[model samples]
Target: MMMKKKSKLFVNCEEAVKICDKSQYNEAGLWDKIRLKLHLILCGGCKKYSSSNSKLTSLCSKAKLNALTHQQKEAMKKVIESESAK
Candidate 1:
């Protein structure tokens, strides 16, 4: 007969974050998502990161924000400088 080993129930912050990111992309397994939720319950920082990542994803999906062009960024910088001068 063969014996099987059980995986650890709790993961460290680093592993937790990796799992969180994977979960964000819908790549994490069911167990991985459960473990991440458990870690977030104990770690405030991880929870905050998870919230922020979720927000950013939501924003990106709603907006077509594919990085600003160099010219557009320069124009924005100029506008900021002019506004600060006023």
Candidate 2:
């Protein structure tokens, strides 16, 4: 019996997802991008996920969303604590 070695370009779904996320953030290296693209070619689910991720990122960027400041979070927490105590 002969064992075949795994190709360096082969990536499982999990790793593909991680790579997809990194690619979205422009954090994936060239090899990782190539692996992700190859995996996406064969994986319908991951392809859909990548599409949705891209759409979501685009929507978030266009939405101009803002986060609460630390003071606002502390105020909200105090309010919640007081309400809980009531």
Off by over 4 Å in 2: 1-4, 84-86
lDDT per model, in order? Answer: 0.91, 0.95
RMSD in order of candidates: 7.0, 2.1
- Put down candidate 2 lDDT per residue, 1-86, tens digits, no spaces: 99988779799999999999998899999999999999999999999999999999999999999999999999999999999999
Model 2 pairs in collision: none
In candidate 1, which residue pairs get closer than 3 Å at backbone N, Cα or C atoms, i.e. clash? none
lDDT of 1 by residue, 3-77 (tens): 866558888899988998998899999999988899899999999999999998899889977988999999999
RMSD to the native, candidate 2? Answer: 2.1
- Model 1, runs deviating above 4 Å: 1-7, 66-86
